[model samples]
Target: MSTATPQKFEFQAEIKQLLDIVIHSLYTEKEIFVRELVSNASDALEKLRHLQLTEKDVHDDNLPLEIAITTDDKAKTVTIQDFGLGMTREELIQNLGTIAHSGSKQFLKALGESGAKNSNLIGQFGVGFYSAFMVAKSVKVYSHSWRKDAPGHVWSSDGSGSYEIEEVDGQRRGAKIVVELKDECAEFAQDWKLKEILTRYSAFVGFPITLNGEKITTVQALWLRNKSEIKDEEYTEFYKFQAHAHDAPRYRLHFNADAPLTINALVFVPQENTEKLGFARLEPSVALYCRKVLIDAQPKDLLPEWLRFLKGVIDSEDLPLNISRETMQDKALLDKLGKVITKRFLKLLEEESAQRADAYNEFYAQFGIFLKEGAALDFTHKDQLVKLLRWESSLTEKGKTTSLADYVSRLKDGQKEIYYLVAPNREAIESGPYLEGFKARNLEVLFCYEAVDEYVFNNVREFDGKKFLSADHSDVKLEDVPQQGEALSEADVKDLTKWLKDALGAQVAEVKSSDRLVGSPALATNADKFASPMMRRMMKAMKKPGEADEPVKVNLEINPRHAVIKKLHALRAADADKAELVAEQLLDNALIAAGLLEDPSRMVARLNKLLESV
Candidate 1:
């Protein structure tokens, strides 16, 4: 009798193209191949785990269900073996030799037809097995079916064009992938490299991953576990491991959602905000996962950029497991997932701020810029994010913060606007002429220190029907203060105002007797309708050419009752030139107080002239 063997077959045309993409351009990092193979092994073990729950006649049930990776640097080969549900000879031929059975054919067809410029689809398409060819010169997969009656088999392929499946003896119940590493790719066979890759990409995998006989995935997938079961210490450890942060988490949210999407998330706000230390704006560090398998370590669009300070894991089971499993096939679903998580996170923050004021304040001080950013840019959740913002206000002591809701609650019965002033510090704002009028009227003004606060407030025009108005805005009209100590007669005020306007010329848009100035001699208001001191500084910092010396007109308001202005009016009539110099000096001093002076060099020279006259 002639012993004839089954025939080997060449790869399909689409499979060849798919292989080329997988081996060359599919994944940004080549180390992902280890993660892919380990993930596949974990899935096989998971299947057996489910099978063990119901099935009684399981083959080799005595063997522990785990993935073991053995590397041989000398031989330039790495073997990933899993003692779980293996495949029969026919199953091997169908799963490895053919493209249709592996479900990769449809993915490749989609890739070719869609012509999507970004190839983030490869990992999500379920062809992660082919990622082996990225570093392997040749691969041999030895598998045996879990059925006691099924025979063992070996599938060998160089991934050039063809593959062979032959019956092999003494194979284990699960699959084992043996990759002969290319000359330049042998670093994967080193124990240290494999362990690092496993820790980074697959540390939280449900199944145990062993590298060179030592288990590497010691940390559990806390996001997948019941929140009640996870201890605080475990959470801290996970945060440290995932976020690479030294300090413990200031706040954490462990939540699961089923309606919008099946999501399991464990998110953390670190104890310190690194960006607050003037580090670069943080990129989104939330690791994206599907069923405990990592999809993207840092997905740019997974969450809004404002939530970049958040660190942790988000896992969704609804995600389709594609070939590479590095990205998602359905973008709409991913976006929905992102929105759901973001909303839930925002809700959690609201709760934290309410329940733990001191802790929340610490977190807010470090990470509040992100909330301000969201308020300015992310329109979908702007209202909710705005509510979470806290600022130093006249109602609160220095370094203390009050929320917009609190600010609204403290508003007087007839107050129509929410007032805020952007300044360098609380002391600066308190000592400025703008706050004097507000303080006289007992009106609260929010103190903003960050440059972005002005932009944020502009975008958030109103909150809860109260318009946000800058305290220093020229358009602000304040209640008239009854003459308390002294008064400038209507004629004297009119004469002084006329003389000041003529003396200041174009530098003063319209000098007038002030209703807002309390003790100060004068105050400068921005003449440009759309620009404030903060806005001007932001524009200058952006280095828009020819913008530094951009002329900004100002409306100067002089306190008619102040001694300096009263004496200056008399000095102007007696000595016109000296009064003009004194008037100019007073205007420049107000501009400096308003943070509107672009160049102080001229002010210093003018001061020297005044000193000589003195």
Candidate 2:
């Protein structure tokens, strides 16, 4: 202890209000105190680094530029020491005691004038040091100024109303904060617990970090480095460390941009989609950083919701954070960053698709749902997202995929629309009546198998100026297949169609002799222009129990050359009773093929009745 007089002061009214808010409601997580103190320590070290470059002398020139944290659970205390710029007796009074010198007066005044409008100014004040009271019963800061003549001092506070500063002897060249943990916060005094928090929130801090004399932040902040200089192994290690993932990254984008905003991003596409494995919905994992110091580990708006699968670090020097450094304050700036990152990732995907087809295909196989989502919902990048979409079409092999661009390349000379059909699988699609006309005309129909594909296509509507049409839609018009064999005469078909419509009654909107069906006797096409079989299923699944099923109205088209239609037509001319049963059976069969049959039991009973009659 030194024989110097002590200085004591009460906190300003604004600081008292600010402190009350910080202690009660500012940070949702109590663990943020570690990040706040570490950041302050880092700033102090940075000040000393700058001082050495410009000033004539720095006290203790041989001290290492690092931060060390020690924990003593038995003593219920944790201490964080740094060997950088330290505070003198006067600084201990000014920096820790009086609010007039703490740079928070301007921040409070700004907040008072702007009311709720200027909350973004909180981060510029550097008041993160005051967050220590959230978990501490009391805090003692011991520091020695970098100036040779300045005496060391200790600042003590319980964070209730006032603080004390006194001269101290034999202090080192940096600040050491000793926190007496409250009973509820005693977990922070354990070595393992402190290490975990440090790893999560402060791992990439520019200065070295150590716990209990062991270094913790071993990996470099690769996002800030030159992309070419980073090694493959380094990237893999960083990915595993940052994402807590086991498998290596399948793809990564390390880039820096300056124009829209200063951005340094290192994003990685994981080897697999965790959400695809039945895990809970993934939260945003891209950590936000400023000058290599973490601002947030899971920022909600850093990227679009469709990009939740990505994991890595994004360091933006332009981010304006709140005083807690836990959330972003500027929504517009965050949106701009999101746009830039999203566009870059999309451009990378395009290049990957061109350069590594097999790898890109594998990625699409696992995570294509997100791209489809972006295509449907993100208008600004809908065209790019659509380009990345893959599908199995008539031109591609069974398991292979094709893009819209490839589909366009294979289009017939005069084709004006892109056609697709939604079904359970390729086999179901091939056996359906909708594909017969397109197949006979040598036209390719893209197969959409996912439940959401219908919704996606409806929102996307068109791509490359070509409208997307559902092959099973009632309004789809196909050119007549060239004459192949003897067919029913026009008068015979006209009579047969009128009689069929009367027999089907309310089941169908229209009955006609089909030009679209090749081999099928009859097919049901949905009358609802916007709804497909898959969309109907989705709506039904989402409906509440006992809700009435949506009415299924379809257009029934008959193929004149098919054996079943010929038999039904001749039977109708002779036995009217049996012919009615055959006509109903034919309509049920068409409904089954169209996946519009809500009750298969009725179809089963009708089939048995027909069998008994035969």
Candidate 3:
């Protein structure tokens, strides 16, 4: 029955070291061992399939090309069996007991050189059979090579630096690895647990996986299929299954790229932004896969941080991964992949915005904040992100929005800058003094309602060679508009400004006659080149109390043509104290309108004094 007694062999030093790492430190999760083993099984099966295509006289030529996994809790063993290519006795010794499959010596040198996790590099080296040691008290591999003349063999090891290879008979077509679970690792021997692992990491594998004789992987990898052959209903079903949601996807990008890198990506935008509905921020949802096996479900840097809401799969055949296949070894290659995906997504957004206006508006209303975040922080994509940004403007109808490209389309001759104002809402901005200057000069002012919008514009700085200027910034100097009514004289304007500056003291950086205002009495403008009052308030809210806030100084622009300014100029000489009180009240009113005033106590007290004086 037996050709010989089991031959014992001591592991090479590098093999021992690798075994130690596998059992002790290689994987972050012991469940990952399931993924690694299944991956190796899949590889073996793939090899057999290729051999069948070219070679004749292959053994078990008609065996089903699939993987079967069984768990026996009573026996405390987990078995992964594949009906593909197997190995002979000499093959088992070389592929398992020695350093051949492991590239053991070079791998240890790589770990030392990187001084960090490089499973991405390890993946390039090869899959380890030693991963069985991670959870096994003892392991046995029963294999029969694809060659008809090759004899079956069993490789057994306790993972204590030595293993035994013995000739065996009646073994089937491929390899079957049985791992007896260690005491603490017994959970892996349960059918339910093995099924869960398979569903997560191996569900998209090229072959069907039968867990305990029941097929578990039923969904095909939709991303890998051709778009022309796929149906709309099929896409929606895949979206529902992959995203675990009942709602249909708002948008789906199924694309394949070759230049720069080979990529197959299928990304979806959910119908609703959960974060917009007051849920916690989403984690990165684009799962990364190599061939068909998952590398990471939520690769943090797979896409820019702003794309956390994207759902689907990204598979690259070119990834150079480490042995564990858990991490990427080449950081530059990873970054290039991310950039390619991001650029393609932006292009998709641009197309949708142009061709599907209503659908895009709905998507943007829910998830535009993320685009704003990208415009602000992801400098590489900022220009593209800025072009996709939309906002309600002074020129648009009440609730309607316009894009930077559209806004620039209507730019008047020699209009060298794009002006915007940050306020709480459209009504607040339209009814406020900031719009008066832009309206009188026939210039459009974009209405930025969200606090994040200001930060976005500040980071974007310019679009289409036009600098973004805040309508209320002291630096803004619009063309003077002609006045129809009698206005205060130059001398009186100068006197009133000097008196108002003295009355307001440190509160007003300077008081000057307005060149832009048409209706409003006055306006307060922040002296900071880019920081709006609302932006400062937002910053202050995020900072600790003891943190130093940037000092604020503002300019007061008094409309010379306004009746209140005329009355105040004369009233100052007739009643200095009353005029001074009115000036202080006016200054406080302007500051409040600008979203600059923090505590209203002084303004409230001064109002009572002004009413008494009246």
Question: Poorest 10 consecutive residues of model 1 by lDDT?
Answer: 116-125
| CA lDDT for candidate 3 | 0.85
Q: Per-residue CA lDDT of candidate 2, range 1-614, in tens?
A: 86588777797777788788789988988888888788788888988899999987888889999999999999899899988889877667666655656656655564444322333333321377778899999999988989988878888889998888888888889999999999999999998898888887777777888899998965688988997898999999999988998879999999999988989999999988878899999899998887766777888987999999999999887776556666555678889998999999999999999999999999999899999988888888998999999999977889999999988888888888899999989999998888989999999999989977887889998888888889988778887668566678888889899999999899889998888888888898888865567788888888999999878878899988888888888998688988888888899889889888878887787778888887
In model 1, what is the error at residue 161, expressed in angstroms? Answer: 2.8
Lowest lDDT sum, 10 consecutive residues, model 2, at 116-125
Please rank every candidate by TM-score, starting with the best: 2, 3, 1
**TM per prediction:** 0.93, 0.94, 0.94
The residue-level lDDT of candidate 3 at 215 comes to 90
| TM-score, structure 1 vs. true | 0.93
- Model 3 earns a TM-score of 0.94
What is every candidate's alpha-carbon RMSD to the true fold? 3.1, 2.4, 2.5
The lDDT-based order of candidates, best leading, equals: 3, 2, 1
Residues 63-181 of candidate 3: C-alpha lDDT, one tens digit per residue:
89999999999999999999888888777877776767556666677676653433333332134667778889999998899989988888899999898998887888899999999
lDDT tens digits, residues 478-586, model 1? 8876756576889999988888899888888898887888889999987774568878877777886665556778898989888898899789779898888899899
